[model samples]
Target: MDSPEITEAMDALRRRLVPGTRTILGIAGTPGSGKSTFATWIQQQFGPGTAVVVPMDGFHLGNAVIEGTPLRRRKGAIDTFDAGGYLSLLRRLVRRDEPVVYAPEFRRTLDEPVAASIAVPADIPLVITEGNYLLADQEPWKEVRAQLDEVWFVDTPQELRLHRLVARHVSFGMDPAAAVAWAAGPDEANALLIQATRPAADRIIPWEQELE
Candidate 1:
């Protein structure tokens, strides 16, 4: 689907959600693949009433915790996140008995993920958790897939994703060279791992493709 069409399809998804389902719609993609924009669009179409988004990025372990790890520099790596905490949040969010569930949101400007930035209220249905490793086969991550009612894998051409990632890194204050290096290096590696999990998703998607 083209951009216009995709937006309509997502809005349609939001309309179909009945209040208080505790349902999760997982959207997974490599960095710079536009998953966030797509997700934000879906939320906007819901018009501030239903279907609030609670991103998994909100569960990133603090820099303090990651600073001690071997994978410290590659903060975006799957291992750097608070996988267990994320699991717990998903469990709570998926519970049918809950009147409301609070979740976090990642703040890019501060480089800190805020806790409890969003709430999945009893009346609003459909929680969207978009991230890199929701369907990963690795430990901790594997369990997340089970909470999702459906998983949508967002695909983009490698070159396009790479270009966008590098630009974003630079915009975020990384030097041009450093941005390109990380995007082509660790970022690409993570992308490869994410690619392997595509088949596990309920739906495989390319941005702008129609949802059928």
Candidate 2:
């Protein structure tokens, strides 16, 4: 997780890629560990080759499913997402066929996710697929890691992650106290689960730079 090792991992991942690779980079980190931010940063750094990001959040079940199922209590739990759909897209994404492929995007404002938000043309050399459960040992999640060419796990301090999570929830309209409670309760519990997968990552990034 040191700086040198982190850069080396990134460099090695870059070296394996060339034009027409359609490389799938998997990034998993606990909620508030900055998975989306880091993925966006990497995409921006990837230059103009159409490197797109397909977040696992896009596969979250609709409101009805969440409300009616046990997942309603733990909205961001490991089992809350539609792992099958995510696997399906990943399987298709790794294919070497021609034509464009559209990936889904999660709409946080509506608290509902949608499929096929981005049209990923076949020419793109890299696709960043990030989420908290990519390395999860659960049935389908364990297999999810296999589809990725390179997988990096983001490791953030527990205290900082809690702070970020609380702030994030508050920004989304929750009261400050409620945000902290949720972050420390369900959110922190999820972070513990994600940290258990750290040893499985090809690279671990502590993310000490330019993050609040």
Reference-based TM-score of each model: 0.88, 0.93
Clashes of 2: 1
Candidate 2 — worst ten consecutive residues by lDDT sum?
Answer: 203-212
Question: Taking the tens digit of each residue's C-alpha lDDT, what string does model 1 give over 87-126?
Answer: 9888887774677777888888888888878877766677
What is the C-alpha lDDT profile of model 2 across 21-74, one tens digit per residue?
768999899888889888887887667866888899988878888897778868
As a whole number from 0 to 100, the lDDT of residue 6 in candidate 1 is 59
What stretches of model 1 exceed 4 Å from their correct place? Answer: 1-16, 208-212
Angstrom error of the Cα, residue 19, model 1: value is 4.3
lDDT against the true structure, each candidate: 0.78, 0.82
Collision count for each candidate, in order: 3, 1
Q: List the residue pairs that clash in candidate 1.
A: 1-208, 1-209, 1-210
lDDT of 1 at 56: 78
